[model samples]
Target: GHFRDNREIAEIMADVQSTLLDLREIKSNDKEIMYLSDQVQNANTLFLQCINKLNALPKPADEGTMFVGSMLDGFFGNFLGSYHRGLDAEAKQNALNVELQSAIAAVDQLEAALLLLPKVAEKYSATLSDSTGRIVVDFNESWGYSGPNDWLVLQNRGETLKDCTILVQLTGASGKVRKNVHFLETWPSNSSMWGRYQSGEEVLGRTVEKTTVTQVQELDITIYSPQFATQIQYVYQGAEKDKDIAQICKDLSFQGAYQPYESGVIWDTQRGAQITLNGVSYIPKCRVDVAFRKGEQSKGWHWNHDSWMKGETKSFNTPKGGLTFDPDRVDFEVSFPNTNYKYKSTLTVDLKSGK
Candidate 1:
């Protein structure tokens, strides 16, 4: 009788949605973000505690948490425990098994999808905080994974952030291969989180344009532009998992599935270092499509960076004639998964500072 009611649950749910709504609006100093963030967290905690309490309640002494056993044997014949009357426990166990397995599968399938959305947001709308002088990204534009193949997009228009470089790393969760990509192509190897420019020397003037993955353990990205420099990391997996949940809705509510099942990085490099590029290489700047596997391969996604999924398709085409940095601004977008909901805003970055 003292249990919390559905009305209370509804109130908490409203609080969550309301807080998230506020999270979408922006004020110059992230004051809205910080305040709304706390409200959202609190609402989520309250909702979860209430839900857990209800789910864990002992169903009157008769209904037992083991109610499923009774309902099961009473309806469907039990082959394993034909003589036992405790079939109730078995049914409850079966239901719980299905639920837990689904949750874990969701994590396996959607982890990459969710992880990529933030990167897409940061990649485009990343901002440089004047207070700390460090480029900052918060997990606001998260992803919803629906499948293994979908559109990914990130276009930033942050006007007040600029003057640094960019770096990116891709790796497998198995700790087997490490991949790295640098935007500046300079700034020396393994530099600190913040950049240090030489006297009167442009950070972009240094050599070494090749992007290499050190091992399968860490996949990371660092960007250095005029006054903008930051890096991001995510865990990758060697094992294949179901990817049907990464679907995103379009303009007319039509759904689209986005999968980054295959993890890698792309960049514009100097001509001399071009030979190092492999595994479905495409010169987006030059429109040159090079099939590293010579146009004959299968399951090639698993192949190491040097040799992608052997026996798989490594075919792709690029645009003609190299890509030139706009100096004013840049954008990167990721495929989105088809997920149905009222929220349909995508990320956009505008370089307001250094542009």
Candidate 2:
């Protein structure tokens, strides 16, 4: 008797059922549930392997040998001793087969429950709620000389949403989809948040005409809040890129000569006082104003319809009285009519020591 008793098989069956119930109660939203599922699968495999090994074992007694023994017992008045022994072995084998079948059934049920774990986990992962009055999502894009800049704007209109996870999908005209996720500790009431969909590095001198190929046409956003989830979609309203003129104006430099005068240190325009924009990208036709201030006196020059291209240098000599005397700092203001965006930046240079 390879198996002395059915206690082990019975315990295995009960354990399988208990594991199934435990899986049913697992309300996990993360990889922990997946790990449990894998463990269950491995246990099921071991059960099958055990059943296979049991089935492969040799039968307790062969049928041919039992028939011969029965015939001899009938003739010799041995009272079927050998035949009875064979019958006992056959009964034990049959009982073992029954136990194996029951084990197989229990394992099958466990596997069926395993198949449903993922669906159940997904259901409990993020519960969706009506965001109609609670949240608002919008999309905006602007074209710039470099490329298109896509932005997702989320506004919380009602109570605060805690542990917010925002997912954004941007689809372009070329059938390319870009996705980005943002996390916020709390989105307060009556507050708005902006997330830019970074499409990667921008090429130099990217024009408006070239943006048609990869222009964002649609936007899908999902907000996962602690209480519930909200999903929304919007058609992208495209606009020309809003170039940060202030950022581009970082390269603007003023190289001029100044002399200490009784009134104030006067910028000596006769000694090659000039302003230059160096190694700049393509700038649209915009107005740029350069000013110098010294106390109450400020002198400035306005360049109308000024634009420069990549690797192009634009410099202009200061007028005889264009720059104020002993200027502490130079200010730059650029206005773009196309995007209606104004950027102001300042540059301070030590003129006395000329560093």
Candidate 3:
């Protein structure tokens, strides 16, 4: 029974190894990858314990006596069994280690693709539109793999932006409206990891996202007309910080509005703004909020950076160019003149010429 039980245990361990190898052969999601990595760790521990027990057992007796003949036979059988078990455990442990390392590397690659690409784009392409009264953002996504087997993974160079927010307020205008909105959208959280993975593909194409993209080869969004608007107030979360991710917003506002208004609160002025996200811990679970007030008490407009969900809060920034820190919420307030005049209407970011 002892020998039979050991065989059964060995078979179970082999099954686990096979399962891990199968996972490595295909594209997998974050949860699946993490689960496999954990399983490998548990197997290693089990193997180590089995080796220790085998090493503690005494070797078989060379001479068998009439009185101790039966005892000697049993001891020799047990000793041989332990020796074989130890060898098997060691071999499996070695293989499991390799699989664990590969799984972890895969997880890191997926994280970069899902969470880092967008952040990198926001860092470099967070620009204010000069020709249109809109905030222009550009993002790129790509994937590749290394090792003997072509594993599906994303590039480590890029970063991601979760629940990121961008607020644009057209001050000194009447009846404001937001247009040309776009996002580097993602699939459902529970969706398959191989949703975008293609077999035998060495290099993934560069994917792009823009604020105001058009179906036509050429397109533009203009927000000013006879009124010729003025003053464009905008704000957004910057890139990852260089160090101390927990205090990522220390340099700016910890959920506070951005001061200096990237491009002076003037019409037709284009300026680029960036917030570093080098080390924020909760990048994937971040949320953003932006508020725009036309008149001091008008209750102008409130918007969410992404989809509206439960437990979401209202805008939190103060008007008149001020910033405060608060991790619990993102608050920024901007007061725009609602003169109700036709010529004083707020136009696009690049329509007017004067400073």
Backbone clash count for every predicted candidate, in the order shown:
97, 5, 27
Better of 1 and 3 by TM-score: 1
Residue 274 CA error for candidate 3 (Å)? 9.9
Off by over 4 Å in 2: 1-122, 125-130, 145-149, 201-213, 238-355
Q: In candidate 3, which residue ranges exceed 4 Å CA deviation?
A: 1-249, 252-284, 294-355
lDDT of 1 by residue, 1-355 (tens): 1112123433434533442343344232464445434544553454344335434633333332332111111000010100111234555444444433332233223222222323323433445333233333221111222211111111233333332233344343344332222122123222333211111111112211112222223335555343444455533222111121121223212111111112237744221101222222221111212221111321111111333221233322223223222122111112222222222222122224321
Give the distance in Å from residue 88's predicted Cα in candidate 1 to where it truly belongs: 12
- Candidate 1: segments with Cα more than 4 A from true spot: 1-23, 27-54, 57-89, 105-113, 123-217, 222-229, 232-355
TM-score of each: 0.22, 0.33, 0.16
RMSD, each candidate, Å? 25.6, 26.3, 26.2
lDDT of 3 by residue, 191-276 (tens): 21110111121111222111111111112222221112112322111221112222322322222222223344564222211122
CA error at residue 265 for candidate 3, angstroms: 25
What tens digits encode model 2's per-residue C-alpha lDDT throughout 282-317? 666778777767678777777776565555534444
- Report how far off residue 271 is in candidate 2 (Å): 40
